[model samples]
Target: MQAAPPADRRRRRADLLTHIVLILGVLLFALPVWIVLMGSTHDGAAIGRGEVPLLPGAQGLDAYRRAWTEGAVGTTRVPVALMLWNSFVMAMLIALGKIAISLTSAYAVVFFRFPGRMLAFWAIFITLMLPVEVRIFPTFKVVSDLGMVNTYAGLIIPLIASATATLLFRQFFLTIPDEFVEAAKMDGAGPLRFFRDIVLPLSRTNMAALFVILFVYGWNQYLWPLLVTTSADVETIVIGIVKMIGTESNIDWSVVMATTVLALLPPIAVVVLMQRWFVQGLTDTEK
Candidate 1:
């Protein structure tokens, strides 16, 4: 056992300092989440009164119950529960649909080389730079043309072609040992079979990570859903929240805080549960 040289010792100290800085950065990023949790547990009055509570007291649950039942402009006066269901259903469908479509497109681009492969890849990749706001009006018209207005198709179909997911999977698939694809092909595994038996299982971590990312996207979608859905009949949780802040005077802070808390649960649970997969996906993709 020998002590490090002076130079190496200083290097180690530098690394330690880097780690300390990184930890502090992480805590700073997490502060807003902590605030949301705290705010969710308090009533509108307490929150408005600046009574900052650190923990979830019994009163917090009571406020949550009230928010869940009659949080302003929720469908059926049970905005929290109603919006939760809407958000869950929409998020799930959009996430699943985007994954399925992205996976298939990525597989095609990765495994099967075509004449215009690079062109197609570049075309889809180009959309990544174009913000949704740029083409939303045309997209709305397209959906309207297909007569999918106010329907699930209008909400989910426009989002099915996630360029980011396609790129992520394509990059991941390229890293897979080519021998696996070769072996599947030798065993008469067609494209579909190859995808089913080889690509998907190996790509589960990436898919899970992508799922969380896209689920959050769908869950927090406001503009598209608002434009497409006419009323509470098919409105999402976010839409309900906006609706709560009516044009008239006097917004109910209590109901708003309560609804906000309730709305936060699904995405928070999603991030917590799939966190390992997300980490693995990022690591694997980085490698």
Candidate 2:
């Protein structure tokens, strides 16, 4: 082979460095997950004794079965299946509800001129500064007063209004060409018709990306669900996992690790499935 040019050699060296760094980053993140997966396969006693198994164990199936069906021995007998279902339902509702409300809120703010529009936008923007932890008490009282505690409505409703989603949609809406609006008007489309037809189609990528993010946020919610749901029937997986680790005497590390794996899978699956749309939206928004 002919000798490579100096520039080409330097570029190749840079590429190698980049790949090495990327591999290291991947390993850094993946190692913990791998450990958890390995731990979940082993016996609870072995894990409790601080024995970290590097390989998969024969008890993998049994561990998962117990975690899914029976949960931990000393904790509440709520199955992991029920907790997963509650988490799924809560995630879907929060994602869909936030998307719907944010879209409409952004549409009104961006596309229409109304009284107190600035005021309304400011009010919503202000909420971004106040996190769930700050408002937990008042929010809980409100839900309790409404008799929504321990109900699906309590889990879903309070979390549906998201300032971040509204802001994202607002920015995305502002980027849309005015020509589309004029064209829609010339085609005799009304406001709602324009929104439903033109705006929604244009926003599909953004919506998909936001859905993945919001779904994960909802699924990972711990404090809010812990507060709202007193009944085992409405308990989310995150809370159930914590409940699994009973006092020091009864902690089942294998089952807890199995539940951890289960808890992580849905969010990972959501991101993986929406990876294309998510990347596209992010790249497009940067433009």
Candidate 3:
């Protein structure tokens, strides 16, 4: 048996310090989740009275039940449930559609030898510099002309083409060896076959990461849905919350917090469930 060298001992000390810092950082991030979960359960009177419940309080379910029913039953308007469905539907469409468009566009640009390829990509890329707000009026006209206003089509169609997703897939595709594409072609595989059989399977990690990112973005979309949907009939959860805040009557902080927590569940679930793929994708890129 031998004792470690002084230099090795110092390295161990540094590693211990690093672990401590990382643990503290994680706790810092987790604190808000803790507060929200606790606060959502407390009644408005209790919460306002500063009687914070560190755990599930006796009245927790009561508050949650009220929030879900919007403080009444058989009202024909469960805004919480309706908004949840709306957000999920819109987010899923945006995620799937964006991935489809990105894969197709990236495959063409990276693997094919086509004329005006750069020009075509550049034209799309240029739009990335401009935020959606800049083009909203024109987009509104298109949606309105198609009679898609206050409809799911209006909510999802305009978000189908994601420049960020395309760029991410393009960069990932570049890292892939060219030999795969050449071999696929040699096997009499056409462009579509090559992409489907070869490229997509290998690009799963990137696609998963991109899907999660796009899903989060779509879930948090407030502006586009707000402007497009004129009535509560079509309002997404984000818009619903904003409307809740602007109600002319007294504000119910407890109900508001409860709704906010419910709204956060989907995005939180998305990140947690896709965490493995997200980490794997980053690791692959590093390699």
Candidate 4:
């Protein structure tokens, strides 16, 4: 048999060390989620009393059912299912809205050379420095003036104009070869037609990646929803989950954990489902 090379041995050692470190990291992150999952399966009294079981308990199904059908104790009266639906709708609207607006804005900036183009780009980009928190009062006044309070439009529209998304799309557009645009022009394609036929198709992966990110961001919004939605009908899961935690004496730990698990599932699923496209998009856009 041939002797193993020193380089091969060193490479193997490095691979083994990398695997060990990654495994440790995974366990570290997963530990809290595991505890939460286990806690959700147990009785509220057990969890509240600090008797956290390592294994799944007999109350798993019951806890999930209660959390789904009825809101957590001390939380909003809205059911978990309803809150989940509302969260889904809000997330989708925000993601789609951001992508639509960003794509068009970025395309115009990249393809058109109209007057004040750079000025417009800079104006939009400057918003990135000022987060929603800074302009909350003014934004709220605008929403209130528009009669959008407690409505889906109120929740989504204000948050949809994302400077980061616009920037990402702009960067990606700058990288597209001019040949494609020239070819489209040669084929008698108008701006809108070229955008629909060529640009959008090229942007598919980026859109998927952005969708995953924006969906999670929207789903996790707490302050904005709380500010805009006075009605329980439009309350998101994040807000609903917080409302679940009552005073120390009244808190139902098991139910709260269950609701947390419910809240986490959708974003997790979205990321998992779009993992391929998301990774590809990130890598491609960087070039």
Candidate 5:
């Protein structure tokens, strides 16, 4: 057989190098998750003794079962199931609420011709600089004054208005053609009908992308949830995981590992399920 040309040989070497780098990157990120998975199957004492489990243990899934039903024995006894539910509710509510508010707000800002329209848009844009951290005290005061503390309303409502989402939706809206607006008006479709019929269908992909991002944001929120919630009934999975990792003596490593695994499932499921829409929305070449 004839030997491969120099260019072909070089291309093969480059492909090999690229794959090696990709594999190494995967291992770098996945190592901790593998250790946690193996650790969760082992006895808590072994982990506490600094024994990093690299293989499966005889404990099987008991740790997970205990974690799911019993919860973090070190910090509190609220069930992992309840915490997961609370987190799901908070994330879903926040994601949906932000999308709804951002969609309408952006629609009005882009489509309407009110006085100070640009001024209103600038005002909303300016709020992006004032994140929840900066306004935590005043926001908490408002929630507290309204008797929303330790309630779902307290956890979800305060986090629902996202300037980032509004900005993204506004940018997307501006790309829509003026002809579509005029066509809808000529057809006697009111603003709401035009929005419902024309805009929403065109925005499905973007909404899916934003939903994934906002869901993860709400799911991973630590400080805000930590501050606003004092009741176990409204405790999120992230907070529960932190609570599980208390003073070393109180730490049940197996339970913590198991809880961590459980906490990761929902967000992973969402991403995996909506991956196509998420990728398309972010990297759309057509529009």
Candidate 6:
């Protein structure tokens, strides 16, 4: 073969290095999941005794079955299925609620002329500083007074007002050409009609992006749900996993691994399924 150019050789080397690094990164993350998978098939006692098996054991798949049907090993106050259901419902509600509210709020802030409009937008933006953790006490108090405590409403409603979603939506709305607004007005379309027809269609991608984020946020919620719910009836899968581990002595290593694997499925499924929409929403130049 003829000698290649230096630039071509350098490019080839860089590509090789990049692939190697990417493979390493993938292995770095995948290794732990592999261990967890293998460990889930072994006895918790064996694992507790410091056996770190990197391959599946003869324990079969009963851990997953027990986790799905029962809450965990020897703990069945709430089933994994039920907890998964609660988390799914909570996540869907929070994602949809945030999208709906942020849509309307951003529309008003962007298109409608009103008193203190900038102030209103700023007020909403300022809330980004105050997350649920910061205002947990008063938030819990309000929920308590409203009797929403331990209810799905309490679980979802408090967390649905997303300042980040509102900000992103407002910025996207700004990209919309004034000609569209003018055209809508010329067509005798009112604000609501214009919003329904023009803004919403344009916002579908952004909404998808936000839904992926907000759903995961709702799914992974720990503190808020822990404080809000006192019953297993409203238990989230995350909480169920925590309870499964328990203290060091009573920890069911195999079952915990199994439950963790189960818990990971939903968020992974969501991200994998909506990855294209998520990426497009964030990158689409059409806004």
Leading candidate by TM-score:
5
TM-score of each: 0.82, 0.95, 0.87, 0.94, 0.97, 0.96
Q: Please report how far candidate 2 places residue 169 from its true position, in Å.
A: 0.8
Per-residue lDDT of candidate 1, residues 51-100 (tens digit): 76667645556656776766664334545786788778889999999999
Candidate 6, residue 131: the lDDT equals: 62
lDDT of 6 at 266: 94
Question: Which stretches of candidate 2 lie above 4 Å from their native place?
Answer: 1-3, 285-287
Off by over 4 Å in 4: 1-6, 285-287
Each model's Cα RMSD: 3.7, 1.6, 3.1, 1.9, 1.1, 1.3
For candidate 4, give the lDDT of residue 26. 100
User: What ranges in model 1 sit over 4 Å off?
Assistant: 1-59, 73-78, 246-248, 285-287
Whole-model lDDT values for every prediction: 0.80, 0.92, 0.81, 0.90, 0.92, 0.89
Clashing pairs in 2: none
- Ranking of models by TM-score: 5, 6, 2, 4, 3, 1
- lDDT digits (tens) for residues 1-287 of candidate 6: 99999999999999999999999999999999999999999998899898888988988798888788876654555878899999999999999999999999999999999899999999999988876668999999999999998899999998888888899999999999999999999999999999989999999888888899998998999999989998888999988877777655777888888888888899999999999999999899874
Could you give candidate 5's per-residue lDDT for residues 1-287 as a string of tens digits?
99999999999999999999999999999999999999999999899999999999999999999999998676778889999999999999999999999999999999999999889889989998776678999999999999999999999998999888899989999999999999999999999999999999989999999999999999999998999998999999999998888666768899999999999999999999999999998988455
Q: After superposition, how far is residue 31 of candidate 6 from its true place, in Å?
A: 1.3
Ranking by lDDT: 5, 2, 4, 6, 3, 1
For model 1 the TM-score comes to: 0.82
For model 6, the stretches where C-alpha displacement exceeds 4 angstroms are 74-76
Compute the lDDT of residue 273 as modeled in candidate 5.
99
Candidate 1, residue 189: Cα displacement in angstroms equals 2.3
Better of 1 and 3 by lDDT: 3
